[model samples]
Target: MSFLYFDNNATSRMDDEVLQAMLPYLQETYGNASSVQHKLGRAANTAIERARIDLADRLGSTPKEIYFTSGATESISTVLKGIAQAYNRKGKHIITCKTEHKAVLATCESLGKQGYEITYLDVDAQGNIDLEDLRKAIRADSILVSLMSANNETGVLHPIEKIANICQEKDVLFFCDATQHVGKLPIDLQEVAIDILCLSAHKFHGPKGIGALFIRRKSKPIQIPSLVTGGNQEHGLRGGTYAVPQIVGMGEAVKRFEFHSQIETIRDYFESELQQHIEEATVHARGTLRIPNTSNVLIKHVRSTELMTKVPEMALSSGSACVSGSRDPSHVLKAMGMDDEDVFCSSRFSFSKYTTNDDIDLAIQQIKRAVTQIREASPIWQMYKEGLI
Candidate 1:
């Protein structure tokens, strides 16, 4: 049986247009972007610059402000560590939320070991951080605020505009990890004053292993020393030869990006059908705003792993793919006040621009069957049915 893909929050399918655009760079124009001496090198350099301009234009930034990296993880590490090093004189404290991606949380954890103070703000049951808590969290020693625009597991959206405004008023630099939101939703940097932002192309129908970082340079010219230093590439910020094909693919992806509302419709339909058919099914963060492509749901008395095992033909996950191997409950859901059992019962069914209603219908069918099978075999499910604790 063919497997259905519903794990778009982990990574999106690359666009065919992006692939076509990248072919020349990968096959023939392969050269060191730093070495613009030969034709191939110049071609590579020009392609990279063009890609930079395209990405910057999409994000409402200038070409000078954009820097490429291996992916969002590297971008997150570079900014967190570089800022911690460069701005330690100003302050050693950084503020973020508990529901952030592991990229931010792990980097903050590492910073904590280095004597830097890190404040992890709390999220509500709906996976939203209180604005007042954010306001109070900013202190004299607070130099940076790192938050994500969307939760990887629940697809819960942060009020980024308001958060950015608060950071601006408090005179603290704000960094937004927009990896899941960038290509799927609309984000205007000029309207939202985020000082530093990072996005991975793989999250948005571009090639894997390539991403971009946008550091605001117009208003105050935020500065941080290079974390990956070797030679003068990315204006001495990031070093090493650029992946020309990946860069080209990212550019094409950005240029061809369009937010499909149909995915949201299909997602809502999937949730509604599941809830109507499956016993005690619930959608987490359903009351809150989310990216159009994701739906995190739970069917009571059904363990997510067991259900997934029964339905091997469908692509689903309990939480972030980065930590999928861990047996621990999802930290994102746990931070949202879900217990270990509830976390294990929940599954994420993210959609994509390519996802269709028929695909959702088939996934729902498989999920219903698998969930029923898992629940039938579960003693806890039997106990629940018998009204026993």
Candidate 2:
């Protein structure tokens, strides 16, 4: 049986171009970027620098502002911990949303344990942050504000530009997690006025284990205590041997995605067609603005896990893969004011540039068939027929 992949939000398959770009570094140009005396070290360092330049160009930032990391998790951790440590003298307070990724939420939780004050701003029914609440949350002692550009589960786009403006006016540092939106949506740091941003390459068509963090040069430099203190890599912020091949792969991936206009068009087509053809399916569009490649649907009478179990050929998820094992409903949905039933019935289907229209059609058919079967067998549906649903 052929299988369809619709989980790009969780992770994307590596592109051939990116794989080819990484080949030399993995096989021949293998050397630690920290070793300065050897020719191999110079070659590895050159690849890393080139990759940084490519990523920075895509974000409309200078190469000097980018710092490499293992993934978005580490990038976020570094920013939260780094800024808190570096600027604690100024303030020991941070602000974030209740719906942020576990990486951000967990980091804030850890900081709270260490006596830092944290305020988690609430979201509206559409999963958008309240600017009024944000304004009220800001304090004289608030040093940093972290928010995501787009939600990983809901695909809801946040008001980063507005938030950044507020942060600027308030003279507080802003950090953005753009992991879900970087390649799928256009981002210009100059326009957004974000002080710091984080992204993981695997969310696009790049290999895993490589990501970047962007820090504004004008902001007071963070004397962030190192997370991995050792041989003075990544401007002495993160100290570890650089993974040259993965960095090269990420650079090539960004370059390709930056030029791919057709990807967005195809994604829109898939979303439009799926909404048109899937009758009675409550399509979750994540408010007015969202990344083009994602669509989360709540099939009213079917549990997401049960539906996926019946149709095993499609690669999809209920929500963030990080929270999959939990029996609790998606915190994102709860924050958006979705009831328990709607939350349990929802599933996420994400697309990629490589996905074909035929794949979309097939997946829809499979989904329709599965829902029909599940609803037919569901006691809840029977009760609904008796006016009890």
Candidate 3:
């Protein structure tokens, strides 16, 4: 049976071009990028540097500023803990939002045990952080302000430009986990002063286990310790041999994914189709500034888990697949002040450039079928039909 994938936020399907580009490195020219002497090594090293240039050009940054890591988790850990260790004397206080990925939140929690103070900024009803609340939270000893460029579950966007300005004025380092925004959105580091940014290739169309960290350098220099030791790779900031195949694949994926104007139309059509079929569905953060390719909804009287199970051919999810096994509702929805039912009924549907109109239509049909089945069988839904809910 054919399956439809709407879970791009969790991971993307690798493009054929990206796979073809990486095949040679996985077999033929397989040499350590750190080896500078042999021809194969030089070829691999050159390919890695070319990938760096491509990533930097796309992000409007310099090649020297990008550091390759295992993925976004490693990139985030390197930045947050590295900054905490290196700049703890400057300040132990770091401010982040409540809706951030587990990568940021867990890392901050780890640092808290080491005597760092983390302030989690709450989001408004639309999942946007209050600029005034952030400004008020800033202190003379605030060392870093970490936030995500786009929310993983709701696709809500943060005001990073303003936040960047605040951090700059306060002389505090800014870190952004831009896993969902890097390829889908137009990001120009030249325009926004993000001190540190992390993104994963798998979030785009590239292979997994490879990502980049963009660190903006200052004249006085920002000191961050190495997350791993020895071999002195990634400018001695990260250790271990580079995964040449995945890095080359990420570069190839970047070349294929240019932001087009029509992406929002596809998302809008899907939302329109969904609202038409599921009349009582509540689209979360629909009016807020969101990434063009994501749509999150909560169909009343329908349990998302049951809906997903009822349509196994539909590759959709309730929320972030990173925490997929958790039975609890989304923390992101809770932060937006959604009631327990809204949280329980939430479902996330994200798309890629490769996602077609036909795919969206099929997904909509599957969702409608699933919702009808789940709601028809529910005792609560029956009570609501009699005006009891």
Candidate 4:
């Protein structure tokens, strides 16, 4: 049997166009972008700047405002830490939600240890933070508010425009990690007024290890401190040689791609079929506004690990890829008030532009079979059937 891939939120397969654009940089145009002496080096530098302009335009930013980083993880760390270090005198308080990616959560935790007061706002059962709570959390000492544009595991989108507005009203810097929703959704930073935004290209069919950050200037320029200091790369904010091939690929992917409505239809069909086949299946964030390709489902009495084992051909994830090795329940779900069992039984299925209708049909069948088998052998299911509660 042929396999089907549904873990696009974890990482997407690179598009052929992006790959073709990167080939020249790898095979022949291998020159240091910082070395402007030779023709080849100048060529590399010019290529990087062009890529910068491509990404900047998509974000409604100028080339000078866009700073390339390793990926979202690095970008998040840089933004959070940079704000913390640069504006400690203004205030060391930072506000963020509980369902954010580990990149933001972990960085905030680290900053907390360094004497910064970090306020973690609570979310509703639907995995969305309350704007009122956000308003209450912002104190006079608060200098920054970091939030994700979308939840990676559940594909639950946050209201960024409103969030940015609140940040502006409070005179706090707004930072958004746009890793999962950048290419999958229509984003115009010029209209949104986000102070700092970060996204990884790999999440959107670009090369891995290449991402960019958009920094907005409030009257004067925003001075973000450096984490990786060695050379003058990334405008002295981040140092090290540029990954020219990855940068080129990222530029092509971002500039050329648009969100596919067909994928959303397929994802909704898959969710409906799962609910029809397995009555116990509960879809997380189904009613909320979300990215088109993502669907996270929880089937009672069926552990995600067992489901994966029962249907080895289905490529899905138990939780975020970043927490694959850990045995803990999803922090994102836990923050939403879900019990441990709900988190463990939930599986995330994210489609891509390449995913077909046939793929969704096959995946639904595999998931139905897996859930049936898992529940049949589960003592909890049997106990519930006998009214042991």
Candidate 5:
């Protein structure tokens, strides 16, 4: 059986156009961007600047504010650690929600061990943080507020505009880990007032090992202390040689980006079909604002691991790919008040531009069969059916 890919939230397939644009850089144009003495190096430098400008335009920032990094993980570390180090005299307090991606959470955890006061805001049942809770958490000594634009597991969207405004009112810098939000949605930094934003190109249709961080430079310019120190690259914010091909691919990906309005329709249809076929199957983060591509569904009493095992031809995940090897239940769902059993029973099926209605139809069919098979062997499922629990 030909395998179907529904794990786009983990990483998307690179676009053909993006790959074509990157070929020259990887082959003939293979000159170090920092080596500006030769013509080839000058050409490489010019391409990097062009890519930076294109990414900056799409992100609603200037070229000077864009800093390229390996990916969102590195970007998160740079922002959180740099901010803590640069602004330590102002305060040591930082705020973030419980449902953020592990990249932000881990960085915050490291900061906490270094004597930074980290305030973890709780989310409601639907995976939304209370704006009032955020408002109340702000302090005179609070230096930054870190939040993600969307949840990687549930696709739940936080009210970034309001959160940015709240942080702005409190005179705190706001950093958004937009790893899952950037290419899927339109992010106008000018309109949102976010102080810092980070995104990885592979989350879209670009190559891996390349991403960009956007810092606010216009009003109330803030300085983030350099995290990676060596050469004078990325305005001396991040140092090291640039990956020219990946950077070119990233630029092309952003240049060709067009939000697929049909993605939400396909996701909704998938959920509807799942609920219609699989008894007691329910969608997580339903009725909440989310990115169009993700659907986290709970198949009652059926472990997602078993379901995936039964349908080996379909690609899926229980939660973030960062912790896929871990046997632990999803931290995002646990934060949303779900029990560990139900969290294990849930699986995430994310789509991309390449996903189609027929693909979803086939996936639903396979899932229905898998759920039935799993539940047939599950004593818990049998007890639930008999109403004996």
Candidate 6:
């Protein structure tokens, strides 16, 4: 059976170009980036620096502002923890939303145990943070406000720009988890007024195990207090031997994204075609502004896992890859005010530039057939047919 992979949001398949760019680093150019005397070290450093420039360029930031780590989770932890420590002299309060990824939420939770207070802001029915609520939440004791740019499960784009502006007015530090949104959508740091931003490369067709954190120059200089205090690497924020090949691959992935302005166009087309083919499907276009590569749909009367099982050839997920095993309804859907039925029946489909129209058609057919098969066996659908639903 042929397979269709629609789970880009979980982790995208490595792009061929990225793999090609990383070949030398993995094969011949293997050297520690911290070495200063060896030619191999210089070569590795060159590749890493070039990749940094590519990522910085994509975000409209200088390379100096970009700090590499072992993917978005570490980057987020480093930033959140670093900011909290650096500014602890000022206050002990932090703010975030209920829909944040486990990385951000768990970090905040750990901080809460350490005497820091956290305020998880509520979202509207559309999965948007209320600016008025945010304004009320801001206090002199608030040290940081961490919000996600786009929700990992629902692809809902939060009003980060507005939130950042608000944080600025309140003189509070702002951090954004753009792990799901960075490469899939366009981001302008200067325009967004974000103080700190985090991104993972694998979510955008790059290799896993590599990510970057962007710290605004205006923010008080960050000192992570050393998560790994040895060798004094990653500007002393994170200390470990750098993964050269993965970083090189991430840079190449960013360069590839630069040429693909029409990627979102492809995703929009897929959404339209899917809507046309599946009458019972309800697409959750999170908010007015969503990343073009993602669409979460609720197909009533069919459980998301059941639909996936029915269509074994398609690679899809019920929600964020990180929380796939939880059995609990998606916190993102709940934050959006979705009922139990809607949340349980929802599945996420994310596209990449490599996804063609043919893939979309095949996915639509698979989903329709799968829904039909599941609904045929569903008691709710049976009851509806008997006028008992």
lDDT of 2 at 375: 84
For residues 292-328, could you state the per-residue lDDT of candidate 6 as single tens digits? Answer: 7788888877889898888888888999888899899
How well is each residue in 162-249 modelled by candidate 3, as lDDT tens digits? 9999998887889999999988998999999999999999988999999999999789877889988888898899889889999999
lDDT on C-alpha atoms for all candidate structures: 0.90, 0.87, 0.89, 0.90, 0.92, 0.85
lDDT of 2 at 104: 95
How many steric overlaps does candidate 2 have? 0
* lDDT tens digits, residue span 155-268, model 1: 899999999999989999999999998988988888999999999999989999999899988655677888898889988999887889999999999998888888888898
Q: Using lDDT as the measure, name the better of candidate 2 and candidate 3.
A: 3
Can you list the residue pairs that collide in candidate 5? none
Query: Per-residue CA lDDT of candidate 4, range 293-375, in tens?
Result: 89989998788998899998888999899988899999988998999988998999999988998887888888887777778
The CA lDDT at 146 in model 2 is: 93
Give all TM-scores, in the order shown. Answer: 0.98, 0.95, 0.98, 0.98, 0.98, 0.95
Instruction: Extract clashing residue pairs from model 1.
Output: none
Residue 147 displacement (Å), model 2? 0.3
Q: Distance (Å) between predicted and true CA of 64, model 5?
A: 0.7
**Pick by TM-score: 2 or 6, better one:** 2
lDDT of 3 at 366: 84
Off by over 4 Å in 2: 259-279
Candidate 2: Cα lDDT at 306: 96
RMSD of each: 1.0, 1.7, 1.1, 1.0, 0.9, 1.8
| Poorest 10 consecutive residues by lDDT, candidate 6 | 219-228
